[model samples]
Target: MKKTVTALIGLSLLVSCGNKNQAPLFADVALADEKQTSDWLAYGRTHNERRYSPATDINTNNVADLKVDWFIELPNDVGLVSTPLVVNGVMYFTGTMNIIRAVDATNGSLIWEYDPKVVEEVKGKRKIGWAHSRGISFYEGRIFAATWDGRLIAIDAGTGAEIWSVRTYDMERSLYITGAPKAFKGKVLIGNGGTENGPTRGWVTAYEADTGEEAWKFYIVPGNPADGFENAAMEMAAETWTGDWWKHGGGGNAWHGFTYDAELDMLYIGTGNGSPWNQKIRSPGGGDNLFLSCIVALNPDTGEYVWHYQTTPGDTWDYTSNMDIILADLNIEGEERKAILHAPKNGFFYVIDRKTGKLISAEPYVETTWASHIDMKTGRPVEVEGSRYEDGPADITPSPWGAHNWQAMSYNPQTGLVYIPTHHLSTNFSDEGIDLENWQAREFTGGLGVRRKFSDKQPREYSASLQAWDPVKQEVAWYLPQETFWNAGTLTTAGNLVFQGRSDGKFLAYEASTGEILWEFDAGLGISAPPITYTINGRQYISLLVGFGGGFAGLGADAAELGWSYGIHSRRLISFSLEGSAEMAALPPPYFPEPLNDPNFTINDEMAARGAIVYTSCGVCHGSGLIAGGMAPDLRASALVLNKEAFSSIVRDGILAGRGMPGQPEITERELEDLRHYVRQRAMETSTSDRTGSTNNPRKEVESH
Candidate 1:
């Protein structure tokens, strides 16, 4: 086996040597193994998804000397949350609308830009997902990017020209791509997210790098049994589910958390939650629900499922395992084992055997009330009484926003610790008056069978933290509390430093071992993306995207309090180095939109009540109560909302589709009027005094069904 692997590697090198311009297949394998560290070649720096750099030029002692090396403003972009990849002196990243840009690594200068033209491609059919792509992928001299409209296109690494394009799914469905495409072994993999939008049976597809031809696809959840299974794995998964789950789509979308192990020759993907989130509606006779919220290992060459470890079995609280799957070697009980460290939404920090998919240890990284603990004997979480909200409404800790979301965490083998960007928010889960037996999924809107409410009265202790946890000991080594519940991801280095950005526009670095603050920089905008470090011309530089907007950023007032109002701050890609000196333009102070109201307009209660339901579709990007959380416009403060003709032009006629406000062409005339009434109602209710402390208030009484 060793000789065969060596011969294959040697042949690949010879082929690459024969053609100097062509990149060899699996050229990033060395970086994945930490043998190459000068460039960041993969989404998580390497295929291990560790997000740790071995470069030590910017160590703890010198990180304080770091200043602005170069910065570029993205004038026409929003939600800049992608990790910029640096390969061979060029930097590549995806911004709003899945627009790919290439720049010089030595100096931030545009080399080329490729716009997917997502708004034009979808033709105003998609209104929810537009500007929230996490990243793009690079492999074999080609850059792979998945568009918001479900098209995966491979571009030439040097010219930014489209090489080939393939549509991953039908456009009529509510599905969208927000996660980065994972490229490995000459194949690029992409997944879509829309668990609560409609009937979505989640799956991940792998395509050939050179061509857009489909290689293989592995469905995260099984389809209808009467239609027969795609393979033996889907048939085996069907037995763990009850009722006609296929009708509801049995969601297990692998939107994130994809890691490839070159040594073991395996692919690992973390599956998402159930379609409706309520087991009573999706799986009447409660079963484990097989693959939902699970980490499944597969044969990458064939997309064949090998083994899986379910994290939140029969997941009822939107506890998705689609967070981060980091592979590391740990010493456990005098034995070295290949382990997968996972801190999923359920609030448990898990260590599982990556090779065999066996549980090693599980502990809560935050306050978790849904499950008391994980039972090692059965490798399942021991649920608390009435925690499922079956008996009544249950207040649970670690809300659906998750203790940890898609924000990447970094695992440093040198420090033997995983630095996690964690939160402590909780939610009140209830199904109070819903007809569970007759429930049906809704299209392009939140169809969650359960209703979740956040309490403004909750203590501030339920905030966020940057925790340095020892994976081997299964305990926190050190932690630093954060002011806001949502922040960016972490990056660790062999220089004993950890870097992270905050929602308050501050990028900071801390001592990896003790969590001591080392350096800080004011980025001038909220950052929801991880930082990456790379070296060119023997000089090291750190780059981060400065803009915040994701699932949590759209969660009404809690996120609005940050004051990263839409169009108020500039989104930028900023880089820093020890020897650099560049002055950044001072940004305007944080501005909060004052709700505009008209004394002459009379309130229509009936229309407003109906509009609240239609607002769910808009709330995914705009805030829940018409508040703007830096992602989109706050309709309550917009003059356009008061004018019927102007509003119709922007919303119904797709006039502003080019600006990221996708027009809802399917909405009727009456529905549009109702929406206007609802926005006006919210504006009238929020006076000057109410705006001070109302951002964290509970959502309006209208259920998000």
Candidate 2:
């Protein structure tokens, strides 16, 4: 009963939706007012996410004549990691499948695009991965977003219409909603992500903000006390649980970083990992499983539970204190305090103490072998014991795609440091053999029972840096390296600069108090979100959201063996400043598509173990078994699986579901012929190990860690 799709075009947007949130416009004192200049509002633009940017008319000696200044392109080729949101001069954002647009931040134009057609709004449910929706939310004149099929919409920021939505959760109770909606005061917040491929559990609600109702949620984990218990914080998270840990749904899903501190009215959120992440089959006898990888502190008006800080305690390797927390104050010994900082994904870097969650330090920026540290007395994590593979397959180290995931770390209180953007990757975890009453979900949920295995699709060489730390001398004041590992996410300004973006399409801009670089721009495509700055009639620009596809589809086939593909371009939103100029439109000329092999497609081992449980949730957008986390298409050089009726008319008939390949009648036809015999038996074992020069049986890289 909650499907309010609307797309109006401006009658002053129905008089500002009958003046909701009592109009003074964008809430929470214009997002924690850093003397609010030329918008950028919330989502870390301020409220201390410290993405910095008090705007300085393109400083640092004219940032090398900045240039560009206008570009649009977006009709997505599946990747343009969002992060826009400027007010007054317009902006907003979010593309590839969580749709929502509304450009014109002073010269870009395009004012209204909405489409919560969120993949046909997932009407029939049962979906996984291809997740996108990493930005949106504005108060007063509306615009909330959050889709991926769990709803939360609201539209109307100057006429993209709608104005109310609410589905929030319960997609057949497997939960979804790729976070990105965090309004303030009048409420809004959201959170959820399939608990490691099935039988889930996780929470984060809080609706209202002018009538989408609800108003409170906060469940992190601890359910099924015979199906009742939404209070006493799930009765003290059901005493850190024991066996039958709610039979697989014990995952702590607070999906993606949420923040709001308008001066300690709190609401910090962050938690995820553990539904079959193999804590001995989901909490066999473990304890600290309470809030999976904690970081609580709620009470944004009634979702109570006011304090937590876990950070991977008994959470078996999918380590996720859901990244990004920021909120600073520092000064340390000379007194000022207040911190919070984070960096999660279990490769450490905490700093805590935001009014009593304690810990004031945690360390290890990366190169970990899983915990050789982090015991700030009782704050835990000195237990590196086979890193939860318990005496087995443990090649671990900052690699649950975490030595920080969900990139977005920038603090700079005038260079007091923080910058981040890490990546040295690692993974090898093991534990497959599950059956918890047949629990399930999808996409490499470590084939259920946590397997992992990623050191960036093997033939190794990962390393993406940007460091700078010093969160009050917790160290590292430098770093810039990179041979590539999904870049983009970090922007510091007030003119001493520090922008980012590279997966080999440059976009640089360094020197926020030493790291140098100065200026760059290649931007032919691949950029993974995060980069913002605003200013209109008074000048200054610097936008971003280039293109690279979400959570990097597990970097399969190393997205074109490392040029970070996404080829056949198109995914922009660009922008720059100082000498304006604008130009771009020049890509068209790279298209590799040639795999359609079959050297007689037969592949048995029970059809590659039923195509590894039908690609354990569709190899997260192709390439999690021959390793290619992203840039789709590369099934051993695809020729549409050597033409099985155009791969069964694009997976059982939706005919390339309008090009994004959508159509999977929840797959069955003997599970799509055992997922085309496990991707044509790993593309004929990667094309007969490259035509016989085989180096001892290779190929199998992608998914987890």
Per-residue lDDT tens digits for candidate 2, residues 497-573, read 88988765678898888888988988766678888888878888888877776665444555544334444566667
Best by lDDT: 1
Every model's TM-score: 0.95, 0.34
Once fitted onto the true fold, the runs of candidate 1 whose alpha carbons sit more than 4 angstroms away are 1-28, 455-460, 692-703
- Please provide, for model 1 over 1-705, each residue's C-alpha lDDT reduced to its tens digit, 9 standing for 90 to 100: 001111121121111334543443445565475756678888898889899988899998888999988887777778888888887777888888888887777666666678888878866575557577888887887888988878999987766778999999988888888889999988998888989889789999999887889999999888999998999999999999999899999999988998998889899999999998999999999999979999999999999999999999999888999999998999999999999999999899999999999999999988888899999999988999999998898888778878899899999999999999987777788998899988989667648898877744443453788999988888999999887767899999999999999888899999999999999998877889999999888898999988887776676676677788888887888889898888888778888899887887787999999988778778867887777677888888898989999998888878877677777788899999998899989888874545432333323322455
Q: Model 2, which residues run further than 4 Å from truth?
A: 1-31, 38-42, 48-67, 70-194, 197-219, 222-243, 246-249, 270-304, 307-531, 551-573, 576-579, 589-592, 598-614, 623-633, 636-677, 681-705
Cα lDDT computed for each candidate against the true fold: 0.84, 0.71
638 Cα displacement, candidate 2 (Å)? 5.9
What is the lDDT, from 0 to 100, of the residue 66 in candidate 2?
Answer: 90
How far out, in Å, is residue 227 in model 2? 21
Error of 2 at 403 (Å): 30
Cα shift from native, residue 421, model 1 (Å): 0.5
